[model samples]
Target: MAAGHYGLSNLIAIVDHNGLQIDGTNEEVMDLHPLDAKWSSFGWHVLMVDGHDHEALLDAYQEAEKQDRPVVLIANTVKGKGVSYMENQVEWHGKAPSDAELVQALKELGGDPS
Candidate 1:
């Protein structure tokens, strides 16, 4: 695994745990509960946050920077945030948007999906 072998002791990998995998759901694939303990075992300080809140993210980054060791900011994000039919739905995980979909998505994202 790249994680275990890539000198990642000094790295902070913020995995987006939305409870969905490439398949149907995360529970169907693996039981990744008690996730903090798992990553701490890998020598990282974990901090969970609200993935959509800008205020929380800013605070988390500030705290993470103050840490002496690697700090994983595990922000739980939706599959398609700011979208009408997609947020938290696993169907759009790897699918790209069509021209029509892109326009709709942009409007949902304050007319800017950038």
Candidate 2:
């Protein structure tokens, strides 16, 4: 709100809303629903996008750049996105991958081990 009042049009906030935490889902850990309304109440121009989609992310940024007020991009995503064993799993939130797991995860993401 203060940012808007001070007229900081260049400020851009991107929130990654991947519901998982080390404890559990964000709802189970601590609910922060109505996120859209929350930022709007703070006088920001809010936009939601699929956090995984590069095109969508780029488009959202472009749209945000046009706003006179500060922009808040709320990107909804999956934790540990590309790995089969880690995707949407809260356990992986703070866990480091084993060597085998790293290989598998990289394979799933189509990245060369070299």
Candidate 3:
């Protein structure tokens, strides 16, 4: 709101709307649905896109740069992203990956395990 009033064209708020938090899914915990509409209601240029796609993210940033007022990118993504076991699992929220899990996650991410 303050940014909109002050005309801060450079201000961009990128929200990672993963839908999963510490406890569980956002719908199970506290539903913050209609996210884009909420931001739009506050006079922000909202762009909702798949957060996992690098190209989509770049495109969103480029689109936001063209907007006059403050823009908010609602990035819809999975919580644990590249890790197969941890993806969307709330237990992994605050917990660091175990040694074995780390190996698995790294392998899944295609990173050199060495």
Candidate 4:
């Protein structure tokens, strides 16, 4: 709000919109739908992009650089993206994976587990 009020065009805020909090999904906790509208109302230039897509992210940032108001990049992503067992599983939020789980996750991601 202060940023917008002051017209801080240099200010850029990136939100990791993974739909999960420390407790539960954003919907189960507190729904903040129309998030882009909320920021826009505050006099920000809002941009939405796929969090996993590097090219999309670069494009959003490049676009943000042209905005006259504060910019907010809402990056929509999947929690624990590539890990089959951890994806969208809130229990994995604060929990560290075991060595075996790490190996499995690495394998699933096509990385050398050695």
Model number with the top lDDT: 4
TM-scores of the candidates are 0.82, 0.93, 0.93, 0.93
| Residue range 1-102, candidate 1, lDDT tens digits | 345445454566678878887777877788798888887787677899988889998998888777666778888887787788788777788889898899
lDDT of 1 at 16: 82
- Residue pairs with backbone atoms closer than 3 Å in model 4 (clashes): none
Candidate 2 per-residue lDDT, tens place, 25-107, comes to 87998888988998989889999999999999999999989999999999999998889999998888888998888888889
Candidate 3 structure quality by residue, lDDT tens digits, 1-114: 787777788999989888888887889998888888887877789998899899999999999999999999999989998888888888988999888889899999999777
What local distance difference test score does each model get? Answer: 0.79, 0.90, 0.89, 0.94
Every model: Cα RMSD to truth: 3.2, 1.1, 1.1, 1.1
1 or 4, which is superior by lDDT?
4
Report the CA-based lDDT of candidate 1 relative to the real structure.
Answer: 0.79
| Superposed model 2: Cα runs more than 4 Å off | none
**Descending-TM-score candidate ranking:** 2, 4, 3, 1
- Candidate 4 contains a number of clashing pairs equal to 0
The list of candidate 4 runs beyond 4 A from truth reads none
**Which ten-residue region of model 4 has the weakest summed lDDT?**
20-29
